[model samples]
Target: MVQQRSVTYVNNTTPLSITTKELDLENCVNDNQVAIKIHSAALNPVDSVISHAANKWLVGSSLKTVGMDYAGVLVKRGKNVDPKFQIGDKVNGFISHAFGDQGSYSDYLIIDPSKQSAIGHMNNFDYLDDDVKARFSDFDINASYPLVFGTAYDGLFSNGQLLNSRSRILVNGASTAVSQCLIQIAKKHLNVETVVGICNSKSFEYNKKAGFDHLIAYDESNCLEKVQSIIKDKFNGQKFDLIFDSVGTSEFFPIIDTILKPRAEGSLYTTVAGSNKLKYTGGLKEYVSVLPLWNYAASWNPRRHYNYTYTMVWPKPAIMELASLMVSKKQFIPPLDSVYPFEEFQTAMDKLNTNQAKGKIILEINKDY
Candidate 1:
């Protein structure tokens, strides 16, 4: 039997254990599935959220693997696997934890082509532009790109409908990995002229260089007042065309009407973080709280003509492909706050819990790979 190391979550009280188990090739790698030797895995907040509170909702069993984003090499291809992908191909993407079967923090992963979200091939360094190539040069860092980028892409282009070059955008939690991607997309792809980012003073320089035209430091004593002031002063009193909230807090809801653009067609306010309240609740309470909060946000100020929506990255291959193309062309740069060896998984999780990581945190799974 082939055995591999995996981080398994049993319960909140018990420490996450690294267990050795036989690889269930037959069950995990089904028709149209591609088996991969995971090289590195990236950490996301949802990993800890689900592990601590929502575990049973996603994984019926008490013991389940934890992780979402991964970059790896294809080792086996099911008979019906797509021709475009072959054994030995290096790929990066995220898996859905909602199903609860497997996760990216493992020696092996099996992805069903028909069901998986955003898996794509990485181009060789020779083909990549020199400036952006160094980032992807490390498989550990490359592993961090897909999930946050996909979430940002879907939030901005799909849910927010930020289609016009004239659109003025504001990204809350501007220092987050997803926000960094959103800032880049707004500037490079959408070609928007005015891009505002909200973060602490420490990240002001980072976000500014990432193409944010204006910065609002939320740590200031009068943060909301400052946000309003920026809109009035820099934007000529114009409301933002779209507000992408990656922080998921309700802090902005009360003042959204003041800063958001009012359009008869409805200005869009999309959030990757659904509701701040839901994050603290668990089990039936969490499930029950989600809808009402969504409703409250959606109808909060209808008279202002702005619509509120929430989004999660649902793994679209096309989005991953588009991101790959942009990265190859030096348009999208992957952001990384830190990388830890697989043995230091707990340390990596600790950094993610701080909510202070400048970018994504990744675990180098197979250092040799």
Candidate 2:
């Protein structure tokens, strides 16, 4: 029996449960599956948060393994695998095996395209234009981006229904990875008029360089006054058309009307970090539950006064293609917070949980690749 090294949760309730272990890999890939030799994988706050509360969602089976984003070489493929995928192609994307039984934090990962796993996407970024590529200078960008980029894409286009020239967005927790992706996409691709970011003093300059037209220091006194002033001075007093919250706090809700446009203007405020401190919302018998769409459902209720929702990123091969294309076109490059070796996930998670990463956090899974 063949075995491979992987990051697995010995139990579901603590980051301490996360550790590297070897597991049997014989027959891991079915005839329709593909296996990737992971060069790099990304760590998201969601990855760590879920583990502490994972048991509630894990069925009676001892579901292990954890991680989502990865980029690497397609080392093996089942005979019936899609013809578009070749054995030696560079592939990258996400796999959500019931929140993670077959995760990306491994030397190798096998995924089946036909099944729905939490949020799934698997594709290759053919970075063909080396001549023009800048910050996308390495393959690791592929691993660092997918999950957060997808979240931003879905938030702005799908949920926010962002009206290009007219939309003005305020990114709460703007220094977070997903918010960084938002800054790039909204300012560059969508050409939104005014993009503002709310972050602490240390990140003000970085957020500005990331394309936020204005940055407010949330740590400063009268942060709300600063927000109102920016709107009055830069945007003609128009309230934000969309507010993307990564901080996961309800503190802004009470003052919602002061910052966000009314629900009638087709405005929205969506958050991923709802109730940041996590506890299991499920029980022992629960087998599967996707990111709760109940929050999204609430947004559609006629009597609901606020247009808000909790969003979960979805798979769109187009997003992968777009990131590659933009980088090749010399448009903009995705930024990185830091890269850790495969052995240092705990340190990475510690940094992530603090919510202060300067950019995306990635694991250098196989440095040689």
Candidate 3:
């Protein structure tokens, strides 16, 4: 048994609390699991949503932790585990807590091999690309990349399939961490030619650096009109072949038909963020009502030939491999906004709640590690 400090859920409406607890290593660590001494963890919007509305979406237990991404050292490994993973390897990955009650908000986390894990070992620092290695030498920045990059890769390439070089793509919520990665992957990996990003003026500089061909600021009242006008002029009235919406507001639902290619084959709209209402509201009734509303709106227009899909990232080995390769090749740079100490958990949550972070926010769990 080992005693460590961890953050645990108090209730649905209250914030998470930190406390000392005893973990039975013998029970938690199995033959197919890897035992890690977590050093840092990153925050995501999904953590806030789940913490606020756990009663409706989460099942199994009342007490839970509230994070998904972690970076740590592999202190122990199971005998049956892969020999490639040795002790003291520097690693980072994400653990989805959608179905389970446990999460990564602790000093120690047990990663099961069966789950959709995105674990990556970074001990071979000498093998890293010179440019990437020059920019980062610690775990804090590496901790922030897994979830955001994995989500973006899955949404753009795996599910959306924007493979054609001539495809014109539009990315909404371009200021988001995931969107930043999507823009780079679309340009570098898919060899996409025309890529436009919709974001506020504050994010214009960052989006430009991320390799967006065109940018539309959506902070003003006539933002939609401006977007339409940009499409008319820049694209010569040709609609987008693919629209990726990281912002799931109802506003875009009405204008989707106007911007999307009419009756074009392989045209698609994919969103990682579900309905805005479902993300904020609590209780079963509110959850039930939001689903039908989306269904009705999506099916209302017959002329909208493009298919609509709501996607959740399922981390796989291929996605992680792609991300790792990009990082090693100096093609992808992980954007890390801020790093907070583990004791200031509430402050970290407050920053994420604002939803204005330019990149990922991380928590340094064991500074001395």
Q: Pick the candidate with the highest TM-score.
A: 1
lDDT of 3 by residue, 127-155 (tens): 54576555444677678878888888877
Candidates, ranked, lDDT? 1, 3, 2
Score candidate 1 by TM-score against the native: 0.89
CA shift of 246, model 1, Å? 0.9
lDDT for model 3? 0.75
What is the overall TM-score of model 3 with all chains considered together?
A: 0.88
Which of the two, 1 or 2, has more lDDT? 1
**Cα lDDT of model 1 by residue, 15-104, tens digit:** 677888887665566668898889989999878776776444444555678888988898888888889889889888888864365789
Q: What local distance difference test score does each model get? A: 0.77, 0.71, 0.75
TM-scores of all predicted structures = 0.89, 0.83, 0.88
True-structure lDDT of candidate 1: 0.77
Residue 121 lDDT, candidate 3, scale 0-100: 76
Where model 1 places Cα greater than 4 Å from the true spot, the runs are: 24-28, 54-62, 124-137, 277-304
Cα miss at 291, model 1 (Å)? 7.1
The sequence of per-residue lDDT tens digits that candidate 2 reaches over residues 1-369 is 444667776446534444454544545677988777788898876676556556644444465677888888876778887677777788777765445577788888888654422222343334434542333325567788878887887778776474687789988888888888888888888889888888989988888878888888878898878888887887777899988887665667667788899988899888866634232323222212334356567777898766888876776666666666566665656668777877888788788777667877888778774
